[model samples]
Target: MEKKQRMSRRSEQMGDQIEERIVTGVYPPGMRLDETELASGFGVSRTPVREALIQLASAGLVEIRPRRGAIVAEIGQHRLYEMFEVMAELEAMCGRLAARRITESEQRALVAAHQACEAARDANDPDAYYQRNERFHHLIYAASHNVFLEEQAAALHRRLRPYRRLQLRVRDRMGTSFSEHAGIVEAILAQDGELAATRIRTHVVVQGQRFADLIASLPMLGSPSLT
Candidate 1:
């Protein structure tokens, strides 16, 4: 079990590095990732590197071809918008359910998570805020007290993590995201399901605008690697 956990952590770290490169356009679209090269660069064995690529493929960040190895996934504009749309609805549902079903303990946990996000935001750390942002949403999903719903939310959240992380790179996005969290938390705490739903839906969907800012700021948008 310990060995498995270690391997899992290593794979996750490798995936994070590769995902960062892709998001920042260092790797760009259609950049074929050689497992051996990545392993050597990261000072790891190919085993973990291969595992990481597989994980990335599942997250929609990479595509694995029979003879081509792994390359970044070329997600189209329409598909990207569709994904954000679904993500908004999922988050809104979580918030709505959490507002009506959250226990006192869960509420406290949510507050703590929000506070952590605030700390991360105030420190001007996008990476830290991203981590806390995850915790904040996870707490709400847990508050929903529906195992299936939480699982669904988690799966999609994992798939969208890279895109969401990129949006945080937009100018002053962390501050705005933090402010949005304030409204979301307030609505949930007040047991206003309708308000929570609306606030969270808007908050998630706002990433679309952030994506636009990111594209505009960058020299060029990366192309998708079609398998």
Candidate 2:
């Protein structure tokens, strides 16, 4: 493969690893990411690690400073609220369109996705539930059948990854989140476009606020990466 292709592939792999680490809480927000350390761990050169960091930055995963290097971007309460508003709108749009355009197969997949989430919750596995919850939303995006909307929603989703995981930190959130997912599916199954949209929007926004509150209640939430 050409150098560019090699670099692209490395970036993709590194990006996925970084995302997993962040989502699994291995690397918390505002935590400095040492490129040299990553490079050694990946058995690659710092050049590729630098490229991966840049990729993460573009995905809103990290921020590069003048001399301090790259650190995971901290989701502040203000940005968290703004991201929630945007995500709620995006999810609402998806729900509205999916109600009109969702195929039988896609609808089945949505049901299965939610069921998987419920199973994870019942098993008391926050890790599994968190993963499935992500898929559930992504399945909704696929059902919508709007390329632009899917891309926008996906980008926003990437940006909100940290907070999304932290949402599960709320007390009894597994059951509560599962209930919210049930409501969303109920609206979709009924083909209630307006209701589906409204419910999903409220669900997303409330989760966003809840995440913000969770962080605020934390004794120490690292430090601000951007500000």
Please tell me which predicted candidate would have the highest lDDT against the true structure. Answer: 1
Candidate 1 shows a clash count of: 1
- Which runs in model 2 stand beyond 4 Å of their true positions? 1-32, 41-48, 65-68, 207-212, 217-227
RMSD each, Å: 2.4, 4.0
Q: lDDT tens digits, residues 68-144, model 2?
A: 99987665555656777899999999999888888899889999999999899989887789889999999888889
- For candidate 1, write residues 13-106 as lDDT tens digits: 9999988888777887788999999999999999999999999998888999989999876766556666778888988999999999999999
Error of 2 at 215 (Å): 1.8
As a whole number from 0 to 100, the lDDT of residue 18 in candidate 2 is 78
RMSD of 2: 4.0
Cα-based lDDT for every prediction: 0.86, 0.81
